[model samples]
Target chain A: MIRHHLSDALLMGYSAGQLPEAFNLVVASHISMCDECRARLASFDAVGGALLDASVDDLGESDAAVPESSLAATMARIRAAGPVERTRPQVAPRRGLLPAPLSRYVGGDLDAIRWKPVGGGVRQAILPTDKAASARLLFIPAGAAVPDHGHRGTELTLVLQGAFSDASERFGPGDLEIATAADEHSPVAEQGMDCICLAATDAPLKFNTLLPRMLQPFLRI
Target chain B: MVRSESVTRADKPGEASVSKLVGKDEMNGTAEWVAEMLLVASNSDEAAFAHLFGHFGPRVKAFLIKSGTEPAVAEECMQEVMATVWQKAHMFDPARASVATWIFTIARNRRIDILRRSRRPEPEDLPWGPEPEADPADAVSLQQESRILGEALKDLPDKQRELIEKAYFGDMTHGEIARVTGLPLGTIKSRIRLALEKLRQSMT
Candidate 1:
């Protein structure tokens, strides 16, 4: 385990944007895996918001020239291209650039998975596990959720499309969720669109319902 | 709490001294303003960029000077940092960090690059130590948080803060800090770890 604990000071530093770059990256990565930290950060954000609302004319302004039409045009072009679409697009070629353990799940061609509808109009492709570990990708219609269930072991999910929120925080595209054995939360895709996520699991699901529990044995994830 | 006690011992003097210098409310305000400016700049507002540059450019230059860079080199690094701001403004994410924090990071990285380049022995001329620490009076004129941080920094056992300043402000790697400080690599790492923990506690 990492020696660091997510304290209020760290959360405030993160939300107020005071951490060193390397430290910030470490905290960001940690928050992805640790919901407790995420919740604390959210609280810090609230405090920051309240503080900002009460203050006025506090920060100094620097005099730097803004880019001309050339930069503006480039940004407009990129924005017009629209958001990248793919319920489970191929693991970006940048997967190699990630740390080793993270790269393992994203190594293969991500587009090849066969998506099958499970429930709530969500499609899932249970990726074949190389060893004892199991991984799956879920594509949920807007405001949908998988059957209510809990994980038996570690489950890592990365949002590939749209956004989703559980009881705690909302995750957008490129956001990762690393859930361990103790975490038990169900996420619902935001309204008006579908949410697609890449999920890697180490064990089978523990469905709340007896019927789904029976089906879990036959199901791949 | 087992580890907390040892950490508290390192920070006690610095924390007490710095706490008297600044109010938490003022620091919060400064942080918020920086975040707002960053948001405006990211939106492609030329005026906003100018406002930010005017305010932060000198601060960045001053920080470099304190880190031991010559005025000329500090000015160059400041310009480079602003140029990066212009080029990578879109990468600014308010959710991630405030503008001052982001600019400081850029400045820190640039300072590191300059120091690294200076480390090589030039055939014609030898590199000198970084410009003398910035004027103590000028350093004092900064915001309360900066003053507090600077004071707290001074209160740290010199050996520990020196390694930290070299690694962070000077951008020296662990091995380089070890070489300059004449401490073992493991010792340097332990000092930094302890220093960071102390800094975190003091800030709280």
Candidate 2:
């Protein structure tokens, strides 16, 4: 069972389409693995639906109106776009290690990643996202430890393969760990298998070590 | 704690006069809209599409404008949203979402694209093989629940409702939602959570 899930704030932000691209990616990747959160996200979307319906009724009481030509113009655009061939929603099989949304960013699964050694036994591949935030896939060998650090802003780390444990708790595959500015910890990979994580952060990590801090500028972590 | 509020809303719909709020006519209209979407999907019926536009077009336009979009751009975005409704009608699953809910999602994405100019990554679509038609009973029950939820929103206090509206209108951030609303996010979340549980039970 997945112990950790997306917070109400993050889920609602995603449902509202307000989160940064990197955060959105992490939220989507987590949902791809956790159905409970998927259902919860649907509930949030339903609220948006409720508001949209209410606004229509409010429009009659208020002064807002659609221009008279709006329908004709929209129909014209539809015609210009030409015929659309209807197709059923296709099934997207999960590629190994990565979910569909994450895979799209990496262009494929584990082997597709272009890994760069970040010292220690840890490697990372930064996924392209908007400037507001950053997302990267971290690969930690079995029994390896990520350096101790604190978050400058909110950080979301989803274990996609294997498991990891920090001072707080253990996070297995499909589990998400949400750390805020107040949190600081060192995470070590479990002994049985290598741990691969999709992690996103709004601000850079506050590394405790001088070496990692020096490499931070070059690594863009 | 928020779960308690949702239970109250679900168990005591009559206190809010939710039945009266939805009204018979509104319930019928919901079903009618679903049928029209099916017509668009199966027959590519222009008349049905026009009917949908006549009802939802102004609302979508207003939604865009409220979210800080310029009037001219809002008009254009509304057009694209409607066109997309036509193109993706085949994907509509009444068992999962009402027409308004589906349209709201499309509009929300459009708002992000225009207002934020950033990508909005969606959860992977649930993988399923060739499927049978969605059960009509499931669809009807789900739509009924949606109307009840809409009525419940109308019953919220003005401050609470406005806070919720601001979030949807893109005027509030996620962190601000709990702070500005004063009431815990759980209250709103629990309310929606009830609806989700019902939806899951029906699907099963």
Candidate 3:
């Protein structure tokens, strides 16, 4: 089985308009199977177009390029249109957990926090950061060990609040740790506050502990 | 020497004379006129805005459809994109891209946003702020087909080429293409399968 989908590379081709017609068909087919790739493709298209639009020339030479309307008027229209917040409707909050507002930086419910019990009295919510598989955010409570495991994905964590320490590095609020899939490390939150972090994961976690490995089926983390 | 096309007089009750000017082409007419009107609109000319709206609105709508937007969504997004154009007329820097590319980009972004929203559950509101103003430095520099896939596309088996164009440009589904093209669905699928492999190898 192909371990990783090739849709991202295909999307890059599409965005560049370099994908030949034959390849374009295959990429489209692959996109139907891969939600992650679909979202990335959408992002690439949006960002690429916006970049192109920003570079265009002004309307004619004789006219001074200023709109007839005042800035206040435009702002008023936007205000009337209301704040364009892109938050998805929640499915009822899971049992005892409170529903957190999904992040707008990524698309849709893909950013929702899915909490799973890891081990050692710790529960982790996997938060997808964006459409691209590069990053995810993991939230863990105080004094919890995330199990002795290595990542099967790239992991970048931004400590939102509280502190956590791995063998070599100590992470505090606002500190970011960038780790690759090959990195082998386990993190434990300090005794004080819960460690909340934004992490980007490229794939599943490879648990090194037998207990976590056994629990993986039930925990679904 | 030009003959008079028309002459309107006040009190003498004389008939008007028509003047004919030679070498006038329609191509030279609308582009220059539209460009002039946009210039005026940019200068805060209210009349110019009206003129531009009457002319470009339909064209923009058609452009959106061609770019793969659904009709209803395209219409709504077109309005918003035009409003944005009006609001940000002063910020347009001509050194980077042509006017068509700029307008097309706005429509494209709006379409993407709508697509993203449709994929998820409808929320009470969208969370992101309005798209930021365009950066001056990020203009599309690569206009030429850098990878040159012409030969690769030509080399594709006819069955593969037909399915691809229908799928990508025509926006037909695999099953739909099968019905219309009279090819077995599996045959269509595998043709595309091999086509992609060959194309990727060549392009990369």
Q: What TM-score do all the candidates reach, one by one? A: 0.32, 0.87, 0.37
- State which candidate has the highest DockQ: 2
lDDT of 3 by residue, A1-221 (tens): 11234333345444433333323333443343333444345433432332232222222221212234433343455457664333223333223211122243222342345655554566565433333333334566788877777876545555655788988678775455545666888888888787766554445667897777887666444
Model-by-model DockQ, in order: 0.03, 0.40, 0.04
How do the residues A101-158 of candidate 2 rate in per-residue lDDT, one tens digit apiece? 9999999989999999998989999999998899999999999999999998888999
Least accurate 10 contiguous residues by lDDT in model 3 chain B: B2-11
Between 2 and 3, whose DockQ is larger? 2
Instruction: Please provide, for model 3 over B36-90, each residue's C-alpha lDDT reduced to its tens digit, 9 standing for 90 to 100.
Output: 3334333444444444444444445554454466766555655677666665554
Off by over 4 Å in 2: A57-63, B1-26, B178-204
**In model 3, which runs have C-alpha deviations exceeding 4 angstroms?**
A1-116, A126-143, B1-80, B83-109, B114-204
Better of 1 and 2 by DockQ: 2
Give one digit per residue, the lDDT tens place, for model 1 in B106-129: 665566467653211101111111
lDDT tens digits, residue span A17-124, model 1: 434332343345445444345434543343332222211221222222222342444334434655323121222223322222222334544454567866558788
Ranking by TM-score: 2, 3, 1
lDDT of 2: 0.78
